[model samples]
Target: MSNSLELPSYLEKSAAVSERFKKLHRRPVKLKVEDLSKKFETPKGELVALNQINLEIHRREFITVIGPSGCGKTTLIRILAGLDFPTSGKVKLEGKKMEGPGAERGMVFQDYTLFPWLSVKKNVMFGLEIKGLGSQKAEAEAMEWLEIVGLAKFAEAYPGQLSGGMKQRVAIARSLANRPEILFLDEPFGALDAQTRASMQAYLLKIWQNVDVTVLFVTHDLDEAVYLSDRILVLRANPGEIDELIEVPVPRPRDPGQFLTPEFLATKKRLEELIRPPELAQNEEIPMIRLTEVGDEVE
Candidate 1:
């Protein structure tokens, strides 16, 4: 069995308890996105990045955002993380309108944003230290998160010494140690190779199970979206709009072999259909007229 099964019993409690937790998490609507739209004005005209994205992410749920390259997945995540602003609509966290970056929201980018100068422990502790948690407390919290992500042994190692996967583990630990209610991951594993990417996906699922954080993950891989998401949000380009939201019915503690199963294949096929172009899989990519890179709307 995988280490996912080695977790403490509490993570494998009754389905009833899980249902109750889901209800509790969904009740307050941990994160609410309504009528969210973002556009960038350019010399030719306005470039619409995201259009009318409405979503409700429950607490502690793992939500994956999927679409083609220019479908506004990254743009939407940036807005949700408060790193960028939406041109129209609002996002609320715990019923409070989110304005700018705060400790309550943490982000892990595709690039290893770890401080090359700082040791893994220090990198994880840096955020807490900035929030004035002090050296002693920050170290303790950082260690805990590092351990949660299975990087405690490498605490003293520098970022340059770690592999791509280990670097990403440290990044996740750094974000999670802050105890943020919402964690936004922007293709954090996109840089890894196939083998490492698969391993990291399972590692992330294990870590997410252990933590009390809600996740909004953006990915270009259909298999990844199907494997990790509780509910996958599919978007289409050309003004980047929501196409559909699909639920994955596979049970928890899924392993790599599960991918070969019929249910998993079915889900993956459905997702492929959602994002694939007809010229290839379904339909042609919607043409974006005057949608050049000059707008900085990020396609």
Candidate 2:
């Protein structure tokens, strides 16, 4: 519960981060999925969530999966994160078959998964503790991550004492403390108020810049995806499929003002078309363009 961050004496170099930026220039794929398909059988009937979904997540890639409700965005990310098995096809990490969840994979859920009774530091150390790290090591590592997320000062605070944004930040610190090779975010900020959501988005962008962990974020927010992701995977509903893989042209350490720029507007408009089909397009309204920067506006 101390405000001190007890990280390792030596900072761990994120090889994952290094590879991500390297591949950006070379454009090499890091994770590959070959014809991935998934289905579910319920008491009601058979449900086809994803079909013939093929894609590659490059190293250190900030890829956002955006789609309408019922699209297989969540299902796809679950499979990639090793939380679910695909009915068909295969997924490989750096060409090795992915069997299940490991230290290499970490998840941040929409709901705050923190143990309410546990203080913030304890919650952040939970994953490391599960990995069998010693108490001193685990506490130190947890504090370091909490510090990175600007929550070291709240180490003794419980989840109930924190706001939605702060809770999510703790979740992020917990996920990052172990230095996972890839981080899966299932609408991590979806529950926050608009102002808080924007603030978290900016905070996340800064973290993505500072760290090398690969991120597969799922959300229905086009602007959020455009603002944070290096590349985006657009999925369509009714038997989910990878309809398009659009690359955001803007550079890293992004400008929050980019949202107001003509280029950003154009990209958001294009994403709407991909996310919305003919019928839905009629009722779809343009998302509000609130162009304000919060926190570290860089990236």
Candidate 3:
């Protein structure tokens, strides 16, 4: 008599995903957030953006933050990246307290931030030059990063000459050329079209796999969160706080095909539930004004 039990298909996929990232757990904590909170003085009074948020990002891990609007997703990343100060608590990187913006951290915003006057390679070399590296050395390192992002051929091109995705690739190469320990991306692909965005996501994974930097991405796209993250940090709105830190149950070396898999679909479903408001989740009806003729309604 066999006593072995068959697990559901989703569970099988989940188990595989877990096994795939088990080694990541063994890695040291790269970024640690403790009792972090932020508050703003508004016309209505004090508004809390983040409340007592705590997190530990593992070395070389890709982490994404997602939540409803005004959930402090941007605020959280800004604080972590040293672009903004937290009202309380501390953020540490590799056991050292982070005080201010430094070369060790890189950031990419949603908008293209390339300098119009500089060529692609020059854009990448800007930071290196600021760090006091010789022009030849900086240019050499910049070209190397461009090659890694598959944009070496575009080195001589201007920002205006490149596509949305290409500009982002240049931005990434620019950030990476600094050899930062962590890269903060605040919806870097938000400005791209759907097809371009998908390709950018794939390109990002390829870059992350090759680079040693840890990724902290802020996004509104649930699919992007599930696709890119080793774990997705879901924040709650109205005095933002950590709701759940989900370990994505989709195996790595990810591809577009996996989007339809049981595990991927299951994970995405959970995200929708968490991020969607209760009213929406319950499918509550909203009063609608009739603008067309009664029989004119189209299914």
Candidate 4:
């Protein structure tokens, strides 16, 4: 027979008080961003991707930027990663101006961007090698990160031998090997099947919990955004600007199962409405020709 046991009332209350005190003492982090803007001048004309945008992304925070396909969500992230330059305004790290891409910032592009010829380990070490790190040290760090992303067993496998999801995992491990202060994910799960995408999201959350880096993820999937972020930034198309900033109140060490909750669904619905296109109202007639396409307004 098993003895039934329960915590004494005083001990339980003490534990609860301790948890509350810890929460109260914790300070919120602040990210400083100011009047961030960007534009692209092609042969057709000058296209404004972002216009006078200002945002603050907290440290160790997870932020998802979502909007219509043509919105400047990608452009904003590119600038943040230092992959592209803003037309005007500024972006900074701890209030210092960002000069260019460095080890402090790492990016995972839409495409897996892995080298087919190289084995997983080699691909993950590509950056370190270019930065002049010794082979032995680079290999050790690369292998550790590969294991973190659950890809260590495939170290000798080439990109062509792995599935899309596995390849993306390699990409993530590679990006994180640099130990960047900020991780920029540009639709990293876009190419995977639904099942694989969900799996990757879970894997990502696990990795995130162990790392203290801030994550700026761009995605069109509202469900994914709600599941992964501390806050969501909704952007609007046509001279892209942040339309709404939604703070996810859900507690973390979040499980993928949380998506089934009413709270999560409600947040997703609200974000969907906020990002819905204003030009096409509920009963509006469809236009045969999308004139804006000719102007190259969409990316």
Best by lDDT: 3
Task: Give the per-residue lDDT digits (tens) of candidate 2, residues 103-196.
Answer: 7888999997989999999999998999899999999999999989999999998899999999999999999988887899999989899999
Candidate 2 — what's its lDDT?
A: 0.84
The Cα local distance difference test for each model comes to: 0.86, 0.84, 0.90, 0.82
The 10 consecutive residues of candidate 3 with the worst lDDT sum are: 1-10
| Model 1 CA lDDT for position 193 | 100
Looking at model 4, the pairs that clash are none
- The runs of at least 3 residues in candidate 2 whose Cα sits more than 4 Å from the true structure, single-residue gaps closed, are 1-28, 42-45, 279-299
lDDT of 1 by residue, 1-299 (tens): 13322222212435654675566455557899999999999899999999999999887788899998999999999999999999999999988999999889999999989999999999999989999997998999899988888889999999999999999999999998888999999999999999999999999998888777889999998889878887789999978999988766556676877776565666776777678876545457876677455776645
Worst 10 residues of 1 by lDDT: 1-10
Question: How many angstroms is residue 51 displaced in model 4 relative to the true structure, after the best TM-score fit?
Answer: 0.9
* lDDT, ranked from best to worst: 3, 1, 2, 4
Find the candidate with the highest TM-score and give its number: 3
Model 1 regions lying over 4 Å from their true place: 1-26, 280-299
Better structure of 2 and 3 per TM-score: 3
Candidate 1 global CA lDDT score? 0.86
Supply the TM-score for candidate 2: 0.83
**Which candidate model has the greater TM-score, 2 or 4?**
2
| TM-scores for every predicted model | 0.85, 0.83, 0.90, 0.82
